[model samples]
Target: MSIQSFKFSLQTLRKEGGISQLSYGIRVFIALCGAMALSWGINQIDMVIPLFLGIIASALAETEDGWQGRVRALLITLVLFIITAFGVRLLMPYPWVFGISIALVAFCLSMCGALGRRYGVMAQATLILAVYTMIGLNQATHEMPIWYEPVLLSFGALWYGILSVIWAALFAHVTLRQALTSLYIEIGLYLKLKSKFFPLPTRGAVDSLRLDLAQQHGQVVVALNRVREILVSRIDSNPTNPRLGRYIRFYFIAQGIHERASSSHYNYSDLAETFFHSDILFRLQRQLSEAGTSCRKIGEAIHGGHAIDLRDSEETVAGVLRSIDYLEREAEPTQWRLFRSLRQLTDNVIALQQELDKARQLEDISLSDASQQIPQPRVTFRSILSQIADQLTPKSQVFRHAVRMSLALSCGYAIIQNMNLSVGYWVMLTTLFVCLPTFGSTRKRLYERIAGTVIGLVAAWALITLFPVEVIQLVIAVTAGVVFFLSRNNRYVLATAAITLMVVCCFNQVSDGYDVIWPRLIDTLIGSIISWLAVFFILPDWSHRQLPMTFAEGLRRSADYLRELMRFYQEDNVSEQVYRHSRRRAYNADALLTSTLVSMQQEPGHFRRDTELWQRLVIRSHTLFNYIAAFSAHRGTLIEQPSNQLLADAGNYIVESLQEVAQCLEQKQLVTDSSAEFERLRNTLEDCPSDDDERHYFVQSQLQSLLGQLEEIRRLTLELQVQVHGEHIKDVK
Candidate 1:
């Protein structure tokens, strides 16, 4: 490639997270090379294995944080490494003492996850380092002092930590930029998925599409959370930086766009049935799809550090406006209710376009809003201890997982001692990597571990036979290490294969690599079986057990969101922070329920017998959330009209019904039906006069839609309750 083109390609890749992955790989390569060079220079080549293992552990412990945070994390990691390593050394002679000590250490470390993601990762890495220390002890010679391996391992971790901090300092904004880029891309995909509803597909297709949209929404929420963390870190570290302020404004813009895009004005099926013959639905679909494309283009610009040109987006908005004008002029008065919804959808699109335009010229924006400050959690020692203490129960998933991991590791160690395998630590290592909090994840990892090991062993044999030179093998090992880091999150099988190949190559440096292959495979199988058994039998966190609480949470958040919207309508001045906070919590809760259902699907069939009912509940709950979003989208001052009282009554009824349903689900009691009350509200809504006020009319339509959605939701919740608790509910006025 030409130099200019190559540079452009690199910039694009960086924006799309490719270069970020490459940067991670490079860091690992650099750390490994430094350790190899230093060990060979000092003629202490025996130390390279421990150093390499420490480097890997440190890398695993790393989280996305600013330089300051990284420094803090690094200190904690180093301290934990020292304690774990030396503790292993002191207890190594007594097998029983060592096994019980490691089990206790495992539970304590696993419980550290209650502190936060950062501590959880560090704890996991520390546990793995303990296992590595065991492996190193097996290879120790009498000439090596007891403190030798622990000190060198700590230094190896320090070496990688230094590199990470330097990288964070130099590229402070890179992670944030990547995160924002991903957020916009996910939002764009969500909009496109929403566009599919306009085609008026079959019921099955629509339900499937709704599920897909929910999954995509989850991704958007995850991206937003990541961006929130990075922005919070950077802003806290340097509050006065203009660049960070601009990024904060960009984040708020993305939030606005997501809220508008996620809003549903009316039922898609009903809209399609009413306007199937009209080109207006098609026009709206085209506009939404184009808006999605614009979002993606804007994301690309952000990634590439290029100025955005939104002339195309402007044209798309104009086309949508023209279509709306045409529809308004030609539609019959009988379809005016649905027509109003169409107009609202068009307005939402225009607003989304405006947000995109703001993002385009974000350089000129200033942070004027007081609510732009992202809240940071206070991390006092007492608070940390409190968080950990809260998780110290059998009901806590983290607690259960900790107990399971401790027992599994102890069992694996016993197997290792009894069998006297050459590299029994590999079995423990496999258990660590394979065991997760959920049955589905653990099962999936078990299969991938076995398959990847077989592939890696076969590939390693072929490579060693073809290229027997030690230097070539070393180069291959480094490359494999880089690949392993690059693909670890998205492609577990490939990562497993890459790491397996690297292990073989590393072992070949000091011994016959072929001898390690069979033992590696055998240890993996043994470990996989142990992890599988542990997760299945020991406090298995089945998703079915949590679905009721999850469903209730979703319902309660939806009601809270509606309550906020009602307050916004009733009060003169509501805080944007409060409204946005409620909206985000509602969306997050909906996303969580959807994800939980997905996890349940991956579990055994008997555990998910109510899957269909749960699916319907999710659809109705999200639909209710969408109706509230629509009301939020069109929030405006309504002059004191007769309809205002009706609106208030209808809104109060919907919120109460939602809360009641949530209460019933949580308590596993029968849901009380309010269909008669709902019908009376619907009749009152239909009888209310519009008084030429479009805003009032819009509010009435949204309330009407919400009432219907709540009725369906209540019915589904009742059916689900019956399925879950075998209770029959009766209608109550």
Candidate 2:
């Protein structure tokens, strides 16, 4: 490659986290190579297999933590590895004891998820190491010391841990940078998806777009949460660092940008219908599209470690202003309300642009009142105990998963013992990797594992035939391992294939590797079937089962958000912390509901009861959230007027209606008719004198829109109740 092209390629890799993945692959490669070299130098080739397995398990247990945290984790992991390995060796002689022990270990390890993600990962790796101990013991060439496998495994884990700590020290900020980059990119994509709604469309098309928007918003929420976690961890470690402070501010700015970008002031269909012949809608669409581009550019800047220019965003804002001005000058008095809504949208976009500018010069930006330090969860012993105690029930998904995994592993072990398969531990290992907490995820892994194993077996046969030399196979094994680490997260199929190939090659070094192909395929198939059956039959946590609670939570959070915004309207000021917290919680709940609905669709047909009705509820709930956000976006001082009590009453009625609907859904009761009260509020609004100011008009229009959305949501909730429960406490009007 030419020098300039090579430079561009490196930059692209760094931006997209290809470099980080490559670095991880390289680390694994080095660990594998070092282990092999040490084994060969000492003429202890039997130790190579266990050492390699240990290194892989250690890498799997790794999480994104700072160097100090990683060091601490590494020590704990080594202790766990030694204990697990030695325990397996102790129980290996008795089949019944081994089977029961393995099941109990599986249960305890799986329950570690209740502690947190980091502990869960370490627990899984430890379980895998337990199986590795069995494999290593079976592969023993001669009688050896009882301490051999455990000692070597601990050494291997410690070696990998040291490498990880060194790497973390060198590249501490890279992960944070990548996470922020992804956050902005997702936000930009969300904006682009939202822009599609501005054009006139049919009702079906609008609902479809809304579903897509909600799903995309979920992705943005995921990215935001990841960035927040990393920032919180880093800041807690070194609170005085200026650079870390700047990143925190940038995160706050992104949150502000997302809130403004996601705000909807009025119904898109109404706006499109009213401004169909005018360019105002088209102008707004272009402005949104360009603002999305600006967000992406900001992401690029963050990734590339450069300053961004706001010239394009400035121009986009100016064009939007001109469109609004033209619309105001040409529109008649009756069109003022729609025009005012359009103005609110324009102002939101302008505010978004200003946040983008803040991202450009983060060094000079002062922290806003809303930019408080993200709270970190307490890690005390009491808190940890409480967290785990809460999940130790049949209702908790984690508890169900732990029970399922233990039973499945025990069954696999029994099959292995009864069938007299020499390489039967592969079945248990396969079960360990393929089984997950959810059916959809477990099913997905099952398919990928089977497909990948078949492909890897075929490829391994060809490679064994073409390159018969042992050293060549060894090199291929290490390379396959590197490829596995690189693609593990995004390309599970490819990763699975690579790992399978690596296992075949490594086995060939110690024995007839060709003999492993058929057993590998058979074990994979058996393990996958077991996992699928386990998820389907054992405490199946179907996504549809979660619909009632998820939907209720979404409505409740939306109500809380609306209540907060009403407080803002009345008091003319609300604590930024409180307001933002409410906004975040509402968005998070909505995102969860959207994501749950998606998972529900992936479930079996029979389990998806009232699918269409559930979808409508999701769309309507999201619409209600949008109206509340619109009111929040236009927060300002209101003049005392005759309609003030009417407005307050309207807000109170809407909030109470939402809360009541949520309660009814949760309780499986009927929703009472609110049409009369809704109608009275609308009549009062019409009779109230119209304020000349556009803000007043915008607020009134938003209240009207919220009332309409709440009514629709109530109707959908009642229908859903009827469909799911067959009867209700009372009938609706």
Provide TM-scores for the models: 0.94, 0.94
Q: Candidate 1 on 51-85: residue-level lDDT in tens?
A: 88889999999878888988988999999999999
Residues 233-310 of candidate 2: C-alpha lDDT, one tens digit per residue: 665555455666677777888887888777888777787877777777776777677777777777778777887866
Give the backbone clash total of model 2: 0
Cα error, residue 26 of model 1, in Å, equals 1.2
**Lowest-scoring 10 consecutive residues by lDDT in candidate 2?**
1-10
Q: Return the top candidate by TM-score.
A: 1
- What local lDDT does model 2 show for residue 622? 83
CA-lDDT, candidates in order:
0.82, 0.81
